[model samples]
Target chain A: MKSAFTRNRPLATAVTALVGLPLLLAGCGASSGSAGSENVTEISVMDYYNNEPDKSFIGDALNSCAAEAGVTLKRETVPGKSLISKVLQQSSSKTLPDVLMLDNPDLQQIAATGALAPLSDFKVSTEDFAPGVLSAGTYKDKVYGLAPTVNTIALFYNKDILAKAGVTPPATWDELEAAAAKLTEGDQYGLAFNANPTYEGTWQFLPLMWSNGGDEKNINTPETTQALQLWTDLVKDGSVSSSALNWTQADVNDQFLAGKAAMMVNGPWQIPALSKQPSLQYGVVKIPVREAGQTAVAPLGGEVWTVPQTGNKARQAKAAEIVSCLNSDKNQMSMAKARNTIPSKTSLAETFAKENPKLATFTELVKTARARTGQLGDGWPAQATKIYTAIQAALTGSASPGDALKQAQGQ
Target chain B: MSLAADLSPSKAQSRQHGPAVDQAPLVPRRRNRHRKERLFQWLFLVPAVVYMALFFGYPVVKNVIMSFQDYTTATFFTGEAPWVGVQNYVTVLSSSLFSTSLLNTALFTIGSILGQFVIGLALAIFFQRKFPLNGILRSLLLLPWLLPLIVSSAVWRWILDKDSGALNRFLGDLNIIETGVPWLTSTSLALIAVVGVNIWIGIPFNLTILYGGLQEIPDELYEAGSLDGATGWKAFRYITWPMLKPVVSVVLVLGVVYTLKVLDIILGLTNGGPANSTQTIATQSYALSFQEFKFGEGAALGNVLVIISLVFAVLYLRASRRAVDE
Candidate 1:
């Protein structure tokens, strides 16, 4: 009996390995559709719209576009931060999805890698889009992606608190400081903004920096030093919370909603959530410029849809069709209305603003907003890192504004 | 044990002396049977060996190869990572942030281990006493370690917030101090606060392991020591310390290895921020690879960290071998 059992065990194990290894190896092959499948049935798509309102809104648009293009959509979503990492991993494995969504600023970086198919090759029209938004999705003068709607940071104030404190929305640097100080009372800070050690921090600082004539290429100049000093003075005077060094844009909105901050610098994405708060009355305006008459050149915020190079020509062309369909004026207007952002097409901006009165301020702000990658292209990441590092050093008192800028700029 | 004995004819010869014919026919059959048994036993180990080879060995080999190449984001799409021959190592070592990250790594590991060990040992000894609801209370102490590290970090972020945090609010309510301490926002205080939270997370792990060791030391030793006038502090000095040496070495060595690679806690809390005061080698390597897309330089830094850990692991194995021999 024992001999029978022992003999059967080895034979059983050998049989299992014989069947399993081949199956596992077969499962590990390339993931995307074949290059020349004649019947082009379904196209896989991926994006970072993992959060609510966006998750469903983007899903609805993608489904509608896939129907228009005569194909089915296979969808994948990841958190906003992990999208690039996922793309790189997929690209290396040759398993990239047909359609990919990239945050606008990240488009140049990925496009420079030659992993994306230029939309011009597919004859997708890139006309009539906002100049800055189009530039963000372009690399080497070839359009790689296009955003349906775009956004930028602006000043959001608690209307009730500002009314009770008798302070109008500040329009320039000096007025901002005075109003912030006068409103500071009890547990609330007068103003709040993100200075966290990330690209978001660099994004928030851009309006202040660009409005004062500071450029990313020349961060150590007097123009930049004055911008850094403005933030430093606020931290020093205690009008802004010292905790801004650790706060993300979401945390700033949290403080604003909690009555712990009278005003915050944020974007229009917070409008839906702000309106959800029944008792919370808020108003929006352009980010205060360094001086009156200066343009408030906020950093542009949005995501762009692109066709990844999956080596499937038919599928690639179809993916570009879906991309264009997603960016159509009709789809752009509807998505903007649903998501509370401004349409990327300049012609649609007037109608979008009139229809969504609450977001009129943002519609005007998006026209003059600057693309982070416009000057540096793929090189913007390293510069953005230095900008935030300088901001943190100055805010924490580890270095003075000029010294911090010099050290961070390595000049 | 039987397999080893069966393989050695010398061991069998010393056990029996018999006539040639009595052993001949049986010897050949017995040898065939033993060989079959041996092959069967090895079949059980094959799956685990293959798993470790695929998951662990492949990544280590890939990382070593990548460290020698000029790997970047472009390499992912083009598959054109050229051999650079130590250029990545030079770049990583030459950077000014290298020394700062190295020092921070050492400070963080030492601070977390020391605080965790001392507090954990004290808790273990206290819990050894016979008390009401002792088992339930001791088990509940593991809640912090049981929670995911990210959850603990998020909660701690709120608790340590300078203005509206629970810690500062409590302090203010008690009139302990007028100004709230900038726990996470200040460069000087951020490292200390990070270490404090890490210690809190680590204490439960150390407590459970050390408490198991304490349980294994028979009570008769303490009873005999008390009779010999070795009571209380002397009992702990002469008996507990000597008996607990093996567990102590294990806890400390494992603590060092684990703490040296801690990333999520620091990333969640401050993201190595407030002027990079809390940046460690592990976090710096992550920033290089994931954030900056300099995969080659990141792999070089990771290999440096692995070399440090390997030295400790080798010393630990040698010490443990000697302990077993004694």
Candidate 2:
């Protein structure tokens, strides 16, 4: 019995090795089977429009585009946050979809991986697109993606509350501070914005930071410090809720809708949800600048469509056609109108703004909007992290604005 | 024991056969029988061994290998992760945030375990009494565990909201303070609040296990102790405490392991915010890999966490062995 027990131990280990080897081989085998084929009748697409309105709108556009290109569409939609990881996983497995939709900021990071095939390779035209949109899609002077429409953050305020408080939408820093303070009352803060520790927080802070002459390249500068100080002062003086530190953009919208916040810094995407409540009389304006003449340079917010390097030339050509079709002037206008975003083409902007008057502020902001990844390329995430860290530290009163910037910069 | 019983009968039959046959031939026949028995034993263990290797062993090995390389987003496409020796480990360990994450991890784990175990034990003991709806109450206590972690975190987020949360509203109704408490927003209070929520989620697991242990301790000992003038605290000290040690060790060790790598609760609650006061090693590792795309440093930090868990596992093994010996 003792001999049998001892002998069985090694046999168990051998069996484990035997089973694991086959499983590994099987994984490799399955991935290899997905390699390029000659005849391509179906074009696979992946995106992050998993929610309503945008989902149906984007899905309809994709289906129409696929029909235009004379191919069947196999589209997969994931949650917003999981899109990048899913793309990376699919890239490594050599199973990346023919067309992949990436958030504008993430396009550069993924393109740097050599996983995306540049649109230039297929001679896709990007003429008449907004400069900011083009810059967002360009990495290393090569355009890898194109967005149909884009959006930017703006100050959204409740008309009823602001009228009762006798305050106009603030256009400059001092007016903003004064209006916020005067509007503060029981159970209602004057302003709400996201300052959580994530990329969303960084995106929200960018308008204030950039409008004040701060640059992502060096956030420790005095301009950035001043921007940080404004956020700190807003929280310190009780004009903004201390809970803004934990609220997401969605939560900020909820606070605005529930009348807990009189004003919010958000984007046009909230228009659908805001319109659902016909009782809500809201208006949008540019996020305020430090001085009146300075432009409120908010970061451009949107997703870009790109063809991944799936090693199938025929499918990639078809995918590029579909992507180009999705960005056509007609589709862009309709998508922007339906989705409440500004069309990516400069020519379409005036018409879009005229049609959707509520998005005029956003369309105006998009003209001077900056792409988060445009400056840093693939190195943007680290700097974005530092910005939000400094925001958190300064707002939480753990460090002064200047000191927080310096500390985060050092990190 | 069952294996021994089967082997003994076979050995006896082999001995009976050996006398009727030639001794030289019987030796080979017995050896053949022994080989068949060993093969059968190995076959019984194959499924479990294969499952472990495929699921547990492969990922661990892959992670360890990844920690030594300069893995990044580019590596996923190009499939080239150049060797960087221990550079990833050095960078992660030397970062200022690493120390903070480590300390927060220690505090989060310790606070969560202590609160869960103590409260869980108390509840388990209380339920040991005869009562109407005892079973129903015990099962109801498991609601937190049954609910998804993200759902619970979201509910807790609203409940602990500074301005409009249920908790602050209650506190305000009682006139405890003028302002709403920032349960999840303040740097000073975030970690504590996270630990409190974790403890609530963890109680059901500890209670179920400890309650099972409590049941296994025969009532005869308690009755005899009572007859000897031991009751209440004395009866528990003498009769219940010693009997519960093994189960207590198991629960504590398991609790520490689970709590050490907790990610979803913290991510949903705070996302390691308010100056990263609530950032733990698990969350930091996740941020490094997924958020920043620094897979090498993430893998290194993950390995560090695995080592910490392994230390506890070894200690538990030693303690359990010693308990068995006694």
Identify the candidate with maximal lDDT. Answer: 2
Residue B275, candidate 2: Cα error in Å is: 0.4
TM-score, candidate 1, is 0.94
Q: Give the C-alpha miss distance for residue A405 in model 1, angstroms.
A: 1.2
Best by DockQ: 1
Write one digit per residue (lDDT tens) for candidate 2, span B58-120.
999999999999999999999999999999999999999999999999999999999999999
lDDT of 1 by residue, A50-94 (tens): 988799999999999999999999999999889999999888888
lDDT of 2 by residue, A1-411 (tens): 654565466557657766776787686653535456767789999999999878999999999999999999998999998988898888888889999999999999999999999999999999998888999999999999999999999999999999998999999989999989988999999999999999999999999899999999999999999998999999999999999999999999999999999999999989988999999999998899999899779899999999999888888999999999999999999999999999999988898888889999899888888999988999999999999999999999999999999999999
Q: What Cα-based lDDT does every candidate model obtain?
A: 0.89, 0.91
- What DockQ results do all the predictions give, each relative to the true complex? 0.52, 0.48
Docking class of 2: acceptable
Off by over 4 Å in 1: A7-11, A14-19, A33-35, B1-45
Per-residue lDDT of A252 in model 1: 95
Which residue pairs come into collision in candidate 2? none
Model 1 Cα shift for residue B76 (angstroms): 1.5
